[model samples]
Target: MAFEYAPAPESRSVVDIRESYGLFIDGEFADGAGGRIKTVNPATEEVLSEVVEADAADVDRAVAAARRAYDRVWGPMPGRERAKYLYRIARIVQERARELAVLESIDNGKPIRESRDVDVPLVAAHFFYYAGWADKLGYAGFGPDPKPVGVAGQVIPWNFPLLMLAWKIAPALACGNTVVLKPAETTPLTALAFAEICQQAELPAGVVNIVTGAGETGRLLVEHPGVDKVAFTGSTEVGKQIARSVAGTRKRVTLELGGKAANIVFDDAPIDQAVEGIVNGIFFNQGHVCCAGSRLLVQESIADDLLAALKRRMSLLRVGDPLDKNTDVGAINSAAQLERVRQLSELGTSEGAERWSAPCELPERGFWFAPTIFTGVSQAHRIAREEIFGPVLSVLTFRTPAEAVEKANNTPYGLSAGIWTEKGSRILAIADKLRAGVVWANTFNKFDPASPFGGYKESGYGREGGRHGLEAYLAK
Candidate 1:
């Protein structure tokens, strides 16, 4: 009989949700064009809050505010003063970490453990890491004195709400650029909370303005003539649109987009560790991650053993409430996202791939899907070719290292990839051949603020951490 763990739900009292949230602009909360969208908790499908939707005019207002702050307030501020503001923001985040984590889990549909441990902590660390760079950017390899890029328009996705906010805002502020940011429609609560943190930090008015809305709002922000830089993290389709929008203009742009990353395992790899990596690579954050290793390429010599072990490990994962401390897999971000996963999984089976899912029970009320995998998947299958953005894995086998490399690089994305092997020589050799921005050998899904993160090719361009991250916001 399988062992059952008792429920350990995190208390929701830590976070105080307001009835209706307004757009955060110019160091204050302002209403939109009278349209409000209800933000729902994906775990219970309950309305969490009504968020203001920014119309084109609202976007214009935000851009104007950010520009004013850039020219009159933030732009002339000394690096030491800027660093002080960043440090204050970081301290506030750490102090209210529990509240932010609870709010994030409720809004994002990620497990409490992840929001509390991975996302929230990293968000704080990102600000803290970049804060130290505010006064030292001259030493960041560009030159002795670098200039700010003026106003930056940033759009972050829903997968990792506050974390992505940090990735965009921290570096921009650290480099002395004021910002106008838009959070994804599905998850805007944490970003809103972050605006409050900015208020607590006493950041100069309009140095960081958050305009919350749907795609139209983001489009307007990206195309605004006042914006000197554009940083976007979302689907590749939208990234291309933003790229075209800035084609004839002098506005700088950086995009961090989609992926269908491959996790390759050789015959000589440690089976248990590889299994853990496989689970983490695809199942982390419900596989909504763009860098998720959704495609698995395994050597044929150990294919059967690895598959058996992977299946055994998967069966033990707990999938349920996002607030549950012990939950391994949380609900899909929304109904639309759940549908996308269902469509791709059905396509996989119809295309002759064998499908398997963990025997874990799913909640009846919310948007949920079991952790699933497809074996005997071909390179042509939709599940293997596209980004499902859910907890689904595609397994493909290879007989040679060359075949593994070819299979891993088959996709248009070059965001991230993983290789599992105990042989150091083969690992280094394979690492040299893979065309991914970040490659993990032996470990997977680990991230730190000191390390630069981004992608190559269609997966998008520019770096988001370390010294390299500051370059995008600094004058060349």
Candidate 2:
């Protein structure tokens, strides 16, 4: 396949602070305290914008606004009226999808194809899906008259910025809760864009507030006494800290965290399809996906054949400019994250895992890591046990179905898992036994608005999509 290069889109000037960003508070844009942070494009290592960094005082102000909205406006609003606002927001999202997609690609370093086609569309769909449920909470199986928990404090990750915001905010609003949302420090552009959509939707003042900042702001939002519920999507380590921080509070918490999912291919599986699934499982979004199937567990009988096919498929992947239609992988999200991936990959080699990479050239000025695979990996190896969260795959082999199941469930994280087999009975039997939240039979990384998504164990608690997601925002 021939590759093409596309010019980077003109980014809004980083120095022009007003055009770049300010905190979205009380349904309007407002300057933060003296704190400000420069947002960088990880792909090109260029500064994109100077975003207002919400300090502890700003967090207090945002939380107070959210609390007041919950007490006076949003919480008291009728469910049908709340549904109308969500529906309007959903429409605005679709109308402005292109701009959001472009901004997301520049800010988060994900491919334009993904942000345009996958993330932006899914975000709009999520709002639409949840909007309809606002007035139908009686049918959501959360009891007869389910009510919103109150003000919600939501913190989303940088991987899928707009989509994560939708995942967090949609359900909270649908359930009648006002929200104070914090986008990841590295990628706040789309979240700020979503605030504009909320304004266009004419959502009630203080119903949704976007506070841009790093860990300290997140900590303040999560620990705020006025916030009645907390939702977070990020690493397990951070999720655990949030869990501990809110242990005895009146706040309800839901966490969608890290994963080291297993992609198991049985001897009876179709080699071509299994290979494609393996590639899509780990390499999608430059392997920045939390539910990425980073561990490849192939049956020993066809291990060599499958590995060869996978390698050939991987070699064809295009890695460069996110805006190019043909680019399969894009840049890493940040310098720190890239360094983490490199360090973990080095540990894989030190711990005796044979590493392999296809012949590919990365961009000269960007943070890029080639698609990497480690063979001869043992279950005890650090690469096999930890979540690398990049385009790095560790291969392992199992001799029997029992062993496959054992190895797949060995990890503490269980967000999702993929199973490939031609045998229907085997697929069902293994699917029933797998400990993960989502089981993709013969397919990997498939998402739908109607289906629920979450993790079972240390991958974190609570569901993110479908009818089950409403439970997180509703009062028990």
Best model per lDDT: 1
For TM-score, the strongest prediction is 1
- Candidates in order have lDDT scores of 0.93, 0.90
**Tens digits of lDDT, candidate 1, 1-476:** 77889999999998999998999989999888848888999999999999988988888888889989989988888888899998899999999999999999999899999999999899889989988999998899989999999999999999999999999999999998999999999999999999999998888889999998889889889999999999999999999999999999999999999999999999999999999999999999999999999999999999999999999999999999999999999989999999989998999999999999999889889999999999989999989989999999999999999999999999899999999998999999999999999999998899999998899889999988999999999999
Cα deviation of 93, candidate 2, in Å: 1.0
Provide the clashing-pair count of each candidate structure: 0, 0
- Evaluated against the true structure, the overall lDDT of model 1 is 0.93
Off by over 4 Å in 2: 1-19
**Candidate 2 local lDDT, 359-401, one digit each (tens):** 6999999899999999999999999999999999999999999
In candidate 1, what residue range of length 10 has the lowest lDDT sum?
29-38
**Model 1, backbone clash pairs (residues 3+ apart or across chains), number:** 0
* TM-score to true structure, per model: 0.99, 0.96
How displaced is residue 388 in candidate 2, in Å? 0.5
